[model samples]
Target: MMLFEKKSPYKQLLNLFLLSSFVLRIVLLFHPITTTSFSWAEIIKIFLTGFLTDFFVFITASSLIWLYLLFLSESKYTKPWGYIIFGGFLSLLIYVACFNTILNEYGGVLPEIGIGFVALKTTFFGLMLFLPKYRKHIRIALFSIAIFIITLIIIQNSISEFFFWNEFGVRYNFIAVDYLVYTNEVIKNIMESYPIIPLFIGVGIITAFFTYKIVKKSMPFLEKLPSFQEKIKSTVGYIALFALATFLVPVLAKQETSTNVFTNELQANGLYRFFLAFRNSELDYNKFYKTLPDNEAFTLLNQQLEIESNATSTQIIKGRTTEIKKNVVLITIESLSADFMKMYGNELNVTPFLDSLATKSTVFSNLYAVGNRTIRGLEAVTLCLPPSPGESIVKRKDNKNKFSTGSVFKEKGYSVKYLYGGDAYFDNMEDFFGGNGYDIVDKKTFKPEEITFDNVWGVCDEDMAKKAIQTMNAEAKTGKPFFNHWMTVSNHRPFTYPAGKIDIPNDAKSREGGVKYTDYALKQFFKMAQKQAWYNHTVFVIIADHCASSAGKTELPMDKYRIPAMIFEPGKEASINPILMSQIDIMPTLLGRLGFNYKSKFYGQDVYHPSYKPRAFIATYQDLGFIRNNILTILSPKQKVKQFDLSLQPSKLPVAFQLYYDEKPKNTIDPTLVNQTIGFYQTTATLLKNKRYQKK
Candidate 1:
């Protein structure tokens, strides 16, 4: 008759699991990964609605364990079921523990731990086998330990997810797995630079204690087994409940996809996101996702690319021919959004040097970056291709030896080098560039004495510029037209620069400060270069990797993707081009400027070419944006198309209702624009998925 008497242990365990899962979901709801801020009322609504999906997933995931327990309740092996459950739970705990620890240290999951993890699981089971007499006591101890471990892991994963989101602006995806290749370097950097180990351990212990106490209290039903008839009834009820929870609940409570990426991501659970990432890590545009007929898609793409009908998918486009082979220096500045520059109407004066240089250079007034991430920008400029779904080609398997920009330079007998202020291995930059025939010059190549300043990213921008000059000088000795790509990292978060270089002090770290420091470093680099012999022969091409702020109400905010691009050749007349261009166009455009004729598989056309059209391709991870003839079209999953009139002046605000698609604007939709949008995105997806970007 007591509250704790004659209760079922299985029911108690299920209650504990549900309670813990709900708590974890509630905590994550409060701490959203997106930059978009929500009001208290909005947050509550999202939490309440999102709970439906979360509960469905939790029940589905735990159903197997519940069914297993039910089966054991009807068998003579019921007592030993506790030991089996303990062993299975312990194995899962060990795997998650190792996976999370490795991810924290190395920024990825390590597959090499599988063998060792299996051995550890076997040892735990072996120990349980020898303790048959103490089975009851061991079960209680193991159950408590499992609950504590799971709680600690949840807290740890939540913290890690926050940091990951802060840097990349999305939940962890398959691209994160690429970091495992540099485990030693990542671990070393974490140990030497970050001092948060003690804090994590302290918080983990406190959380585990509280979680254990709650779990122990939840196990109030623990007395005895039911009679055969009672068990049969309970089993049938559970099976029916399981079927409803697993099948019907998911269908009824599925989360809806929204036009706002932030909202869609907010609705997602971390475990769900991780599972989705793993499931679609290698997507087939034709089979897994939406697509068009191959021939039709290719025909559309060929027309857009202005290729011959008989030409093969990978057929090279022979661009303008020239006798001169100029030394090219491509500078990709990090987080240098166009709006940050004075030329773009910003009054900050943060990039005075770049602003002044823009006036003297062949500046492109309307250039859009292909995607938000640095890797995406890199892929666009180097491969001159459209953004593919999932991860960038740079991080994908067998991504090397393609017809990249470096391959063009290498074929032309130029010394091609990919220069980075940070570890090129961080995002598979080293592998991609090296595999494409570019010699890698990164932080590892720098001497200790050569580094005047440094941060977690790598050597300061000034030091990197100095090293670049030294490398180019050596390359010049060989009398080869060298192509050097200097990817700057000073304009990144936790921005630090050498003292006394800029008006903004190192202690006053901010985005404005980072921009100013980056400008100062460039000014210094040009000053130092002016004295060098290669200054006059070399053509300096300055472009941004991507914009700093990619978040907006619109799916692909054109303003955010608009970046400054200028080709600076000494003693040449400066002219501004107002044509809309994409980042992928830069390579072919550069080649045309140098008058170099080469067989290229690039989808980007030279802006100066007679056949060139003023258009841009922009995208989020999942949504594709195409702009042409003053119209903007967005192609999203499920074959949804949204179009808008983007003829409004860049300096002016869009009419309130004209920003996105809504019920009121549905009548004004243009079928032509919609078709054009679908054509471009579908074709691009087909090309990328089929690896048609490269010629056979």
Candidate 2:
């Protein structure tokens, strides 16, 4: 065996291909893993995205590398670096088209400049590689031009979106430019930011260099080139490896997707249609509780959306109700539920202060929390739509769309103020609230002495409530009715209450103890509220943002969505309304009692309205249930519809049940009612697809 066995050209090609791929992978491996740690699933996704992106990259790079190396090689007019270069270029173009095709399917339009930058990066890799002379300069210049055009397109298209986000803090799903914004800021916000992006880019550059050297050292001269059959044999391993990568990428992405508590494909797309249904139709975000579909599901769902739109239009035209009204205070209690509170018939007297308040106020016994998260609760109580499933409105494309509440109230001159004990930026709620025209006060706004936080989430509930009271008192001095929203935070995870205030049993979990402390905070808040001048004139609307569960029993079924909602008129008497309702219904109900004639874009009906029947819309992370007049229908992909009879003292469920069985909406299988219910859910899905809310 000589130094080069038969010096086959085919061997040279195989070596070059492998070298290119290895270089790309090594570079990627050295690149700091994105600061956003890759779960095994994300790692697989990286392989997939990288596989496609690098295919073209390798082609262009290898060709450029071979050309430069041939010139440098001095001996390789024999190397036939041209053949490897040609193969790489062809493969890369195919890869770009495939990636862009997927993007185009979702209506993406990449700027010409962005395309140019991609070409440049490919050229830069090739130039660093050893290559031949005749084709080297032309290829380099062409690659550079392509890179320049793509970068220009990217920069041009991104500038507007960049300003939109930086100046206004607007974020959207799939905007691509937002990634650039975050990347740029990764170095700026030292504490509240991510780190992996730059590391990967740096490592990638280094790996490319080593790969080219490997290719240059290993190539054979043209006189020793192999036959076509040998070339095919040599390429089989590379082909099989590439094919395997192609099939694995999406599978890994989907596997990663399953880890999320909620599942909604619409989140993968934008929630544009749902927002449109919100702005243009009558569906409320909080009041609606179910997964919103993006495309086909949305079209089918929106068939009867016009009916709701007409209702909304009717309310808008009729305008604000002229009535002797009280000021409004909307309190979003953190992680509260009827099951956890003593007043809602729970066994433990966990909420004694709230219990006492319930007796004096209009207590809604069957109010349900829609989504499982706090942001979902925010959207529900404020925007009145079903939860956006896996995606949050604060981070989605619909964030810029003006929801009707703040706009409607502001139009009426009701000064709006929002107070939360945490970072409004956490759920992107601060930007969202400000977009809707509410003045926000969060942890960043608090004075040093006034700030006492249990953790990074926000300030304590006591301080937040106190500040809200002070703000309300100041507003009262102006004699203008106001809209105040207070979102509490102490009852959240890693719960910590004020020191030495109350002694929870040692056996109880820290969360349960936190709940006990929040109850005390509520008592203190009300004590302060009573002293405020606006107390008598304000109609207090209180509802939980979510529920609290200890380690043992806090898990959810459909019933976990059941939480407490109460309306209190200070000088008024207590009353019980046993009708089942949900968070989506809160806004409409409050507006109704205030004698506001406007109809709401809510799936929930007013519990206080005599003509309104009780229908509970319940949601778990992956399941949805409809409970009306004691009959519950749980819907899931695994099992479609499950019926339960809550009319039985303790709700009874069938062990093995079928969804579309003999069970009907009214228990009589009334086709008309079934059509109405089906129509409603379908219409909701359509609204999400259209993003109807953005229109308004």
Candidate 3:
């Protein structure tokens, strides 16, 4: 009867924990917080796929606990201390489950079992507390691990919250992971945007209390250990089972289909996404995704672009400009959404100065940004290309000495400079600009005395404006036309500006206040520029790096991508153009306005050119969008293409749109629009993958 003494109490506890984890995961999956509804078959598929990922996590977490149980279970001190450790871990699991459930309720998604892996890491630290020999150091070690775990959870949750708010509950994909490489900048931005320390402290206290209560309750379950031979056999069996589970889980869990991006993302685990991001940061267009034959793609693209037969993939167009030597200032404002401006029908007057300036400037009301991130915006304007999948070229390793806007300016014999309020080193801006022949002028170039007000992001907008004036004034004295790309930072979160500069009080500290302050800074910058001799001769180009919000039901929301773009000339009459334009169009359009004749490789077209057709290119990290002729076409990986009709006021009435997949249904879809979308995206992707953005 004693031969197989009913499974050890420890093993019983392990089984209960694993079962509880599975049930908890299944419950969360059924109660998914998503805008889209799923069919029963889709739900079943999601559950089964999700279960495999959860099972793998469970096996990994339990195996470590099993190893500890098998080796240390026979020790005289193991039973009492092991029970305490297990209870503490169980409490952590409960806490994580509670946290995740709450997060889901708030329109967030996390891995069903990813928290177990996180909790398991914390549980190992509790092992030291179980050793009687280290009793003297137990309190300190336990406190340290508790604080560490709490801090990590708070930080990660904050990041998830931000991403969900801005990216529509998408998990940490390749783009998100790429952002992590800039740890210093990311942490500083987080600290500026949130009250991180206080929030973490509150969470820490609550978690600590639960952990303490569980440990106290488990102390009473102390019992004598089984034989050594029995322990060894259990350890061997557990290891073998764990090995088998690891090998089989991924195979059984088929990769989720991408019928719908939001649905696919809803079924994905956040932790698994992070791992996937790291593994597939860079995608080969011809391999992982759909692509047309190279020659056919080029033929279509050449026809759409209206290129000559002899033109290369990276063809250089000769610009036609009369005022090529005029001073140019390109001011890229941070988080300046078109929605915030009164010109865009906003009554808040968040950008009063900009609104007034729009009347005296040539404004493009229908301009859209290429991507959500600042780097993407920069790439669009500088490189003048549609966004490639994965990371922006600005952040990539090979981003140096390309045929950029700066290179074009340099060739025009103008002194080109990239002016940033913050460190230009962030996001590899310095590398990209420096390699492209632009002088870097940033926070480091400013004197301590010159900086009147500063925050984690950078010096205030007013200070940067003054610095720009000072720099440009010097350049003016040299009698050479100067090109300055000034990137402002005050519109960013934790927006702080000098007192009395704007109607909104500095202490108000809100996004609206930030927008107001940025408007005020622009007014001051213009005031200072007007006093200078070079002011009248300078043509100022003002545009937003990207919009403040990027979240929506559709991956590429038309309204969210809309941004204000203007060209201000002293004597020219102001006019508004409603033609569709993209961020990539900025450079070519500017060159055309300046009447500069030069050979250039740019994907953007001069909007004012006689043969130019109006269209805009917009994208998320993976979805390429082409908006033209009141129709929007989106191209995704896996040979997927989606088209939507926006002829019925898309921004005002999104629900009225008609959606089509693959081929357009009868006369419902425009065949020409479909061809243009496919040609542009496929050709651009092919060119980027083959390093053909520059002359070979």
Per residue, candidate 2 scores C-alpha lDDT tens digits across 1-696 of 111133422233334444444443334333332111235654555455444533433333233333332333322223366446644754665566556644455564553444554565456445534454434555445433433333333232233323222221221222222334345332333222223367445434443443343334334432234444544553464455446645543343243233222111111111221222234222333244334333433333334222243313112222234554578889988888656666544656678888888889987776778766677788778776655434556556567654556655665568888888877776678888887788998877788888654454567788887788778888888877899888887775456556766677422336566677788888888899888777888898889987653111111244456678889898889987766677878876777676664434454445555545556555543345555644555544322344444433332322211011122233443333233344445454445555655424
C-alpha lDDT of candidate 3 relative to the true structure:
0.71
Alpha-carbon runs more than 4 Å astray in model 1: 1-45, 61-141, 160-206, 219-257, 288-292, 311-322, 452-455, 496-500, 503-509, 647-669, 685-692
The clash number for model 1 is 0
What's the lDDT for residue 79 in model 3?
64
Q: Judging by TM-score against the true structure, name the best candidate.
A: 1
Please, what are the lDDT tens digits per residue for candidate 1 over residues 1-696?
121122543444444444554565455445443535666755554566556655555555655545543443323334676567657756766765665554455543454465456566566555556665665555456556655665565556565555555555555555345445566655554454344688678757766765666456545422133556766776676666657766744453345445455555555555556666676765554454445666666676676676645223354555576546889999999988888887667888999999999878998878899988889999888988778766778888768777788888888899999999888988889888887888999999988999998887889999999998899899989988899999998998677678898889886767899999999999989998899898899899999999986755467777778888999999999988878789999888988888777676777879988878778988876667788877777766556667766654434422321222221123476766666555666665655655665633
lDDT by candidate, in order shown = 0.71, 0.53, 0.71
Which residue pairs overlap in candidate 1's backbone?
Answer: none
Worst lDDT window (10 residues) for model 2? Answer: 261-270
Q: 1-696 in candidate 3: lDDT tens per residue?
A: 111234333333333334443453344334333445567877776667765665565555554445544443334336676676667777777777676555455553454555767576555545554565664346334434543453344334434533443443465666567657877776676677667898668656654654444334333322334467766676676677678877765554346564544555555555556665687676555655556666766677776565644223455466665555789999998988888887666779889899999999999888999988888888888888788877788887878767788888878789999999998888889998887789989999999999999887789999999999999999999988999999999998777778987788986778899999989989999999999999989999999999887654466767778899999999999998877789999878889888877666677988888767888898877778888876778777766667776633434422312121122212365666666777677677766665767622
Judged by lDDT against the true structure, how good is candidate 2?
A: 0.53
Residue pairs in clash, model 3 = 321-595, 321-596, 322-595
Q: For candidate 2, what is the total of clashing residue pairs?
A: 67
- Using lDDT as the measure, name the better of candidate 2 and candidate 3: 3
Off by over 4 Å in 3: 1-169, 213-266, 308-311, 320-323, 647-675
Candidate 2's C-alpha runs over 4 A off are: 1-322, 344-348, 401-403, 505-509, 549-556, 620-624, 634-674, 688-691, 694-696
What TM-score would candidate 1 get against the native? 0.79
